[model samples]
Target: MTVLVAISLTTGILSGIWGWVAVSLGLLSWAGFLGCTTYFASPKDGIRGLGLSIVTNMSGVFWAMVIIHLSSLFSVEILGYVVTALVSFFMCVQAKKTWLNYIPGTFIGSCATFAANGDWQLVIPSLIVGALFGYTMKASGLWLHQKLNQPNSKLAAAEAE
Candidate 1:
């Protein structure tokens, strides 16, 4: 609980600055997207999930956007399902082949932007930012977890003094 709170406060501050940069550059970082995805994807497996989520976001978003653009040519409403199916399929295959089933985070992360923007070009850069932010949070969480778990030997000693 303490670990989670610390991460929230820290990332909140960091994200405020990052959001400013995104606003200045007219680029959407979507840092919270990665944090939520990571939290839900692997609550127990911290470091490993963090690494896999990064890969998933990078590859999944790019391929999903590609499929979205191609499907646009069909000019059909059901094409949305087709695009989602294709993207999900590709991510699943990658997960199986790489032995990292967590790769679904990539698809999960991309789905929103794909539906809203459908701009294939932003896929690469946007997912990259997502992955990086996910990594940052996971690493911080892991660090906090360790610190919190540590025996309070120092505190005990200070209290004795």
Candidate 2:
């Protein structure tokens, strides 16, 4: 099968398994999926992509926390919006750092954190595990593709027969 097909199948199977495991462990499955999406969306592949996804996602979480705390200080309500806007600007600007260059990953992380209601404890682990899942899926997919395409593999042998 094609590499794309292999990757798709691997991702689909692992995602279902991740959902089950996350729920069983009392973790946030959605956040894990977001982390997985971040991994695939990363500009780089392999370990570099993994690192970039994690760092950017964490940075997003940090910014979201800052927005949550700083906005809480004011009762103006509108100030919350203002603080969010300001913090969002900072989030975009922070992309100057190479590790945080993945803007979408950061946004995804921030959204996940917000959804978790600032519970970084749950969000952080879930994201990390999800990113790991993404990496594993890709690696497994490539391995499967290689095995299928090998010249002397069972498929090839059967075809020759």
Candidate 3:
């Protein structure tokens, strides 16, 4: 809970000068999405479901925007697509059995944007981007999980602190 609060404050501060509204909505949606997904996806109110879901957003949205906009002098759209793919992939990696669980966040945002702009051309592109980023997120998350679970790594040390 404390960590979540800290993340919220951090996100709030960072979003304040940028797309505050988008970030705020993204945060709330992410939380609700996390909770609902966990609730429905898990057989019991287990820690894995809840924890994984929370971690997905703890840094997910921020990174999505960060990678998309901060990576290079390339177009913002390229970054957006790359970020989306990477994040999505990482999500799959973290919760190996629940690959589909990670798609809602990406799909929702993509569909909404396409709908608003009535951009049929964007629909396919958005889906591809979402899948790529989603996979990256899953892979990275699972890697983090593995490294953290190691007996005597920095991740274990940090956990003991």
What's the TM-score of every candidate structure? 0.65, 0.93, 0.31
- Candidate 3, residues 1-161, lDDT tens digits: the string is 24335434443443342234335433333333333333234332334534443333333443444443444546656776776677657644543545234444433433333333433233333333333333333344445555545587766789999
RMSD (Cα, Å) of model 2: 2.7
What candidate 3 gets wrong by more than 4 Å, as runs, is 1-34, 71-73, 76-80, 94-161
Please rank every candidate by lDDT, starting with the best: 2, 1, 3
**Total clashes for model 3:** 26
Candidate 2, pairs of clashing residues: none
Q: Return the top candidate by lDDT.
A: 2
In candidate 2, which residue ranges exceed 4 Å CA deviation?
153-161
* lDDT values for all models: 0.62, 0.94, 0.41
- Model 1 spans with C-alpha error above 4 angstroms: 43-47, 75-87, 141-161
